[model samples]
Target: MTGGATVTGEGRTREPRDAVRARLVDVAVHLLRDRGPDAVTTRAVAAAAGVQAPTIYRLFGDKDGLLDAVAERAADDFVAAKAQAARAEAHRGADPVKDLRAAFWAQVEFGVANPEVFRLLGDPARVLRSGAAQAGRAVLQARVHRVALTGRLRVPEGRCVDMVQSAGTGVVQTLLATPVPDRDPHLVGAMWDALVAAVLVDGAGSADGSGAAEPTASATFVAFRALAPQLPGLTGAERALLVDWLARAETAAVQD
Candidate 1:
């Protein structure tokens, strides 16, 4: 009977608020994965978590809110796993383009496997404003930036990010639209190859790895843009101005 918990009939402290929240999300995620989204009603999750129905409302506002929490947790874990995998691949001298392509395929797998969360989080307006969505995009952008740093990217990083994000979403939706038995397993690889062709120069992949490359005219600006925050002898305003210039230069070079 303290700050965020209570004592049960046996004088043992009840679960902490955070632990209870995690338990609810765990149950909801299992329901989502096993029984589908429609089965994750507030009452169902509450009963699954061994809590009063009102406890769900108090913690998550409503069933929709609970779903959001579940999805957000899923998104965070997904991003973290991707990041760890990327680091491991980087150590293995993986080509940046290949790494990005692998990431794209994994993302497609995620989307298709979690149809309910995919649909819930896919709302345009919600994606625009969601922290989870933004974090996911940040991972994509970082992978693109790695490609840029390798001098393999032909387009500006930002433009490349938009294209990849749009393409991945389309691939996911198209795959999900088809019946499970009829879904095309080759769709993701074919789409990824086409996307890579559009965004990378011929002979674009690097064996020098993710560390560095002989900077192309465009990649020079891209590289500098990534380092803008860490540039010495620059005030914050100067750093901002440097990034803006680099972005403009990179965009113009790609557009030309």
Candidate 2:
């Protein structure tokens, strides 16, 4: 009624307002997935959805608003998937170590499976400035906190959630940043294994010969876990800097 042109669907000439909004979003998502975010525009979305441009604005407020909606949808879907995976792990009566590992892999798998959505949620330049991003981060942080409080992990109470959240974020960031051919699954798997191992095993002695002694991949994760508790007081940019340094150190060590 507001944005989309009326079309005959089963002999009906009237279009529901909700249907128009849904169509616009669906088209916008397809455009984003097929051709990056830059290609998604109000005009293009309207054209694709057979809706008027003003309708998109009315429904979404603005381009950024639409992007925010898209991101929220994607984030909600990902959170649900992670929760489901965790539940399945619980249902199977998984070992704590194995359950953690499975959860880490589930995050990575989702990122790889939905690269566009992953990028939308992860790009700092795009996300940090947005209210939607902050809201999404809060939701995720709460979920991480809930898991840590359950005491299934052998990590410090202060650092456990941060360690898991950062590791998962890093995995997605690495995958998105690297070239396709160079996106080695083995390397990703090793990084994940090292992070999980650090959480499950305490002290330097337990991690000896665990294949994470090398500073780049394994040691870096351990260091981050050790340092996570100090992060809450940091600014977003500061947190990014710390994580970047850790990643660089890990990369160098792994290459060595």
TM-scores of the models, in the order given: 0.82, 0.62
Q: Tell me the lDDT of model 2 at 121.
A: 77
Compared to the true structure, candidate 2 yields what TM-score?
0.62
lDDT of model 1 at residue 93?
71
Question: What is the lDDT, from 0 to 100, of the residue 47 in candidate 1?
Answer: 92
On TM-score, the leading prediction is: 1
| CA lDDT of each prediction against the hidden true structure | 0.81, 0.64
lDDT for 229 in candidate 1 is: 84
Error of 2 at 214 (Å): 22
lDDT tens readout by residue for model 2, 141-254: 444433343333344434555676688878877887889899877865777667756554332212232332222344445456436546788887888787677556645543
Clashing pairs in 2: 216-250
Q: Model 1, range 1-256, lDDT digits (tens) per residue?
A: 5887889999988889888899999999999989898899888998999999998888889887887888788887888898788778778977777788788879888998888888867877667767878988887887887777666677777788998888888999998899989988888878877886678765564323343334456666666777678889999999998888888898887767
Write down the RMSD of all candidates, one decimal each: 3.8, 10.4
Deviation (Å) of 27 in candidate 1: 1.2
